[model samples]
Target: MSVDEFCRFCHKNLKIKGVFSQSTKIFEKTSNAKTVFDRLIDLGLTLKRSPEKSIRTCRRCTSILSRIERDLPVFRKWEEEEKQSDSSEQASAPKAADQSNWDPPASKMPRRVLHKFWPNPPAPNQTRISMSARRSITEVMTHYPSSKTVCNVCHPDDAGIVNNISKKNWKTAAGLMMRHKDLVEEIKVKILELVQHECKTLCNPSQGFILWRSSPEDLKSFSFSSLESDLNRLSPFLLSIFSTATNHSLPSTCAAAAIAVRGREPRMSAFSYYLNSILLHGGARKAVFKKLSKMAITTTHCHAVGKLKEFPHTCGEGLQLLEVQKEVLPTSGADGLTDSAGQDDEGIDLGGAIGTHRQRDSQLKHDLVDSSGSQAGQMCQEKRQKRRQEQSTQEEEGAEWVSRKRLRSEVQPSPLRLVVDCSFDSLMMFKDVRKLHKQIQRCYAENRRTLHPVQFYLTSLGGQLKQNMDETDKGWVNWKDITIKTEHYHEVIPREELVYLTSDSPNVLTELDDTKAYVIGGLVDHNHHKGISFERAKELGIQHAQLPLESFVKMNSRKVLAVNHVFEIILAYMEMGDWQEAFFTVLSQRNGAVPVDQNGQAVEDKEDDDSDRESDGTNTVKDNTSSMPDQQEGANEQIEAK
Candidate 1:
């Protein structure tokens, strides 16, 4: 049992020279494998240990030492079992394998019992590391989960749970915020505080210095409950950062701001939400528009001034040249005064300068060459006029070109524009869902206790849809709406599993139809209905004109797909609706029928509870549609200052 044989045979000829050197502390100072193994043996252990003689003969001492240290628990267990089995023989057994059988009898009962209680170990040749230890390493390295129950030690709270869910378990992470309200609020507060402090510090000499100084790792390590919570707080700061940078281009500045603010939050959605928030706030929106207007004016002036500089130098030099032409015209005297004047039709008139008769007649006889020069001068004037006309046309064209390709203008549409990528049918459904979410949030904010189950579903679905739309580059995809004429107790299914459902009829409206209704908005905020499937989910879907499944497996999958899509659309619609309200208030001085508060500004509020809308409204039950005739009058006139 010498260390040399174990190192040479078992260690695959591995070397341990630097940190594992013979004189290094692992081998010399801290006690070697032989010490640990011998200690266990001295405690009446059955496991064999390399004595000092055996240790001294070892070739690769560090490897043998490490192996023995790692296996100490196993050896300790075997020793205990042996002692408990036969108290007398445990003292006499010198060879390590003598007391404990390394290859115990393979009985069916024992194997069955082991199988029932424990997972099978990794094959001997396949793994040198313990499976549990490997899993720990994996959890440490990854930002996501890998199994049903992640190591709770690695994830103490919902933040850890969310971090692992995307990679290891999407189901757990997707709805994490709904489940962990307290944690979500705590995270939201921290982020808001950070953002507010960062924004206010812009007045300092070292403005934006904190963002530049803080490492991304440190920022991400800050607790985050959900992506949306992070966006609500962090977005304003990110947009402000770009807006404040004087010389930075908008696109580059926005990108840098996005990176700087990206931590535990999903960076892409955060970017979109942040930009949207800027558009929502009146001051930020005004600042952006002002900059754009100034830019356009400055560019136009520069170009126009440049073209003006190209105008010909004409006043003094032209008069002198014309004087010479007048003298020459009379010298070619074969024609009368009238004929010569007609022949010199293109010549400039010297009549206005001929105040005195002497000066006029002094246009004395001149040579043929001067007469020809006068004609040539006339040609030059004609050419210059034509060039000016062409230049004017080109200038107009150039202005048009610049207008089309301006820097900020290119990126402007990306932020301010709302694109609906889903099918007509789905979009209509989304609209209903969005309205529901808004109503729910208004209720929640107002401290209303109860919400109809249908209303809750609609609100919660809206939030989910919004999240999905924000997650993708293209935003949302259109699907035909499920329209049913008759109601039935149809089985409900998830949206995804219904991918193969019947296509729209030839008469059905496609997404391309201009008149198609869009899923304008929604919110997935109902917290109490977690995990409860809606009644007749599958049957309801089918009755609502969803296609039948091929088998039970397909039916369940289709149900799930349908549900997921519905939820995703719900999320997208709700947030978009929130932004829509915010944007309307900023741009139009009216957000549907939402009333202004005492501060003379539209209440820039979130619809957290259903009652919030009614309480906040100066005229309770004010219309919430932008389409009503005289909508502006309703918002401005309906609410008197109180």
Candidate 2:
């Protein structure tokens, strides 16, 4: 087909002599085959006759002839020698019986001469050799559907040659090597089927959008401005997709459908429409409406209405629509553009109408209605401007009103009181507790004098006294005025009862019971304090005067009395100037209270305490002894000597 073939008649017994003879022969033949051979000559497959004329031959076929040609390069000499031999033989030849019927004998010619002039036509199978040659080339190349093949027109490394081998061909080449030609074609068919199915399925408008959208090349070609216009115009597409879809896929479908239907209509501002719709239908569609309203409020609340004055045109339009119309426009005349004659088929003469209004005798009328249209339109334009000015004035007036209202609703007298009975050792740890007490006292004094919002009465346990806390003092807080009278035992009495009180006057007492209090042990050492039990207090024991620390409660769970004993040892060690040993002993809760005489003097009992006391060369202090103290001292000395 590509002109490597030839006609049977063209190659038959014809001795080619000159360029003219070949041309005349080719011109005589009328077969399609001859036409193909000429085309083959043009394509350089067949050889030319001489310098003056061109002929081309298939290089592969010519290569075969070249092998024979190499055996004899003296073709012109050989032809001339043969012609001379023929002329000499013919000139001396006797006339044959029938010259026309006589055929030449092969024996009469030399072997080279026989090989040269004798045409050995190929066998029947080899007759279609050109087709076979093409098939052989295709076979070697693994028969991929090449965009071009190696022919007379192009070479293997042709100008358009690319290294890109098809993925399909890669597999087919492997298949051909494995000798599985059928399997290769089957695989190719399946792959093609899948590709076609995918293309067809995704070819619709919505799916097509996704296909294009995802492709970088396609997206580069798509127009974003056009897409926005589409979204505006195809709002119904979005609505349809949104309404039909009720699951996770809705968003994608809506986007695709909207894109597919895009650019079909003029644009509407989405944010404005969304906000207005919410405000209008919020009562009916409560959830959706509320969401929109909340977003609107959030947006508007941060926007300074006063700043709207800077953009007079935008603000004015909003105000006119909202305030002037109260969001309800008259059906017919609201636009204010309808001529008095009304309903002109050719539309209103806007230019003429504006001209006529300009000729009016009043400047105020001109202000109300501009060259634009309608008083309504003009009012809308000025609404935002008016709102901003009004807002500024309103803010100033509101500030004065707020101040007067505050003066009238001054703080009322507080009748409730709080009190705390802190253990002395536990209360002394925090430096700020004293300051807090002074503040409470000052606040109480002020309340008594002026009768402010709050009143207080204060009391604390003065000394160590172990009294059972009554149920009233167990996690109970009083707020009533009648109970205030009954609980009043003293103006300020230390009854070993944890109490917080507020006084309206120096005379009126409010005893606060069961209030939470926090105790901070001494900063230097913390192992000593007998405050009320935090856990037991929670279960209605004595209400704790101090909030027990989590670390303390977790680290030490002994009885409050035992903790107090440890505290006593720490205090006595500090007094005795044995703070270093005390520090270690307190850290691990291994400290024990020092033995004391009846007069409450710490006495060294055994070897350990004595060793600590004598470690530092400071003499222990001695106190005057009474008769009872002398007896207690004698007994303490014997115990220490033990």
List runs of model 2 lying over 4 Å from the truth: 1-269, 281-540, 543-642
Query: Tens-digit lDDT track for model 1 on 1-642?
Result: 223322322222123542223322212334333453454343332333334212221334435445555665686677678667765675666658565666664332234323322234446476333111212322334245544443433433344464656478767664665446576787779778977665444323243322332222222222222222333344555455555683545545544554444332222232332232223222233355344334321112222212112211222221111123122111111110111222332354332333444443343222222444656667877898987777788788874322322353243111111112121123334444454434333322221111111111121232434544344323123312222111111222233222212212112211121221221112122222222222222333421122111111111111222222332322333334442332232223342434444443434343333456557556455444554556544433321100
TM-score of each: 0.16, 0.18
Model 1 TM-score, all chains together: 0.16
Residue 39 miss distance in model 2 (angstroms): 74
The stretch of ten residues in a row with the least summed lDDT in candidate 1 is 549-558
- Model 2: per-residue Cα lDDT over 377-492, one tens digit each: 76887997877777778797774222212332463544433332233324343333333333333333333333232323333432221121222133223322212222222334
lDDT, candidate 2, equals: 0.33
Lowest summed lDDT across 10 adjacent residues in model 2 is found at 328-337
- For model 1, the local distance difference test gives 0.33
What's the lDDT for residue 237 in model 2? 36
